[model samples]
Target: MIYCGLILFIAASIVHLAFCALKRNKAADATKVFLMPLLALTSALALAPRLPESRTAFVCTLCALGFGCIGDVLLLSVSEKRFMAGALSFFAGHIFWIVQYVFSPNGTSAYAWGGRMFFFIALICFICYGIVLASTYVLLGKPKGVMGGGVIAYGGILCALNFTAINAVVSGINGKAALFYLAGSILFFISDGVLSYTVFKKDIPYSRFIIMLTYITAQALLAAGCVLPYG
Candidate 1:
């Protein structure tokens, strides 16, 4: 079932990417919605791998991915309200991830190397970085108040997600799996940066295409990360 779900997700992802590449905006928008449910299903299958199940992880991941789907759909529109809505959706998703990591052994479980402090410190640093980046975006990017707030909030949430993912690795939760999540996180941050710059700052040539590519890759990695066997 896990392999089947993974295969189905991969196939759907390919077709979704094709729509984006072909610039079939409507088709792309329609197809993108299916990705998260497929991803959530893929992640669900991973929960049964071990004896005592980690139901929390499964549930939170599904919640986050579902919100991601909503965000994706909302983001297809260019309106400020829709953009804010999308940002809120992603913010909620990140919150779910933070909660999932915080209480789990992957986060709360201490390592012999004493890496708990690293995650504590990393979380703070990530938030600070978000503030700095948001400040820069506001100063140079020139987004409006609502959009700017959404950007700033979303930036913080994204960083929070990344920090939790890193902590998952440091705490020996799922080495390779965590790496996949971390990679997806980094790409998500980069993709949003490009999106803000392109939307508010000067638009670079083919910037839209670049954003699409990064966004698609980020989502795929995140989906796969959810189900990667712990190493």
Candidate 2:
């Protein structure tokens, strides 16, 4: 039943993206855009694996992903380009995932390692780098137009934070888990990168289609990663 729902969900999403891409200005239908992914997420959650070792963290991550779907919808709605709100929404969602990780074995169940702290520090530095890039593009005079670069900045950091949490839990040793997260992250980046370029630069390309496709893949992978077998 769950797998069937997943298949239906993906089919609906593909149709949604195809329609959005084939028709211009039709991408503004936030309701249709929002519903498909939310359904996919709901169905995915139903099939999530229950593991004694990381059940709580897995559940929390699912919740964060749920919130993230909402964030994705809001990002689509901001026709005027309110980057800050979109960023804050996603930032809140990412923080929840961080909370989930912080409570995980590597995060809270075990002793802190210098290596872990260093990883976080480096991650923070990377976020700072993205912020600088955003400022240079948005804060300066070189504006893209409606797609505020700030939104991209915040979105990038949010993704990075989520990735950091994933690393904390997955440890980069497990092939499936790592690959799932990596693929999801890449898809999300592709989606948002297209959004930023389209909105700010006023470049009209078929990127929205790619964004929809990649976003769906990212969420699907996230759900799958959460359900990996536990020994």
Task: Write candidate 2's Cα lDDT for 1-231 as tens digits.
Answer: 666666677666766777768864565354355543555455445644445566655666666666766676667565554455655665666665456545655343343435775578667757875675566455334655443455555666655655554554445433465466556656666666676666666656676677667767776665454444232
RMSD to the hidden true structure, all candidates: 3.2, 4.7
lDDT at residue 82 of model 2 (Cα atoms): 42
Please identify model 1 stretches exceeding 4 Å from their true place: 48-52, 108-140, 229-231
lDDT by residue (tens digit), candidate 1, 170-217: 666666777887788889888888887766767776665678778767
Query: Where does candidate 2 stray beyond 4 Å?
Result: 24-31, 34-55, 81-83, 105-112, 116-149, 152-156, 162-170, 173-175, 229-231
Give per-candidate clash totals.
Answer: 0, 2
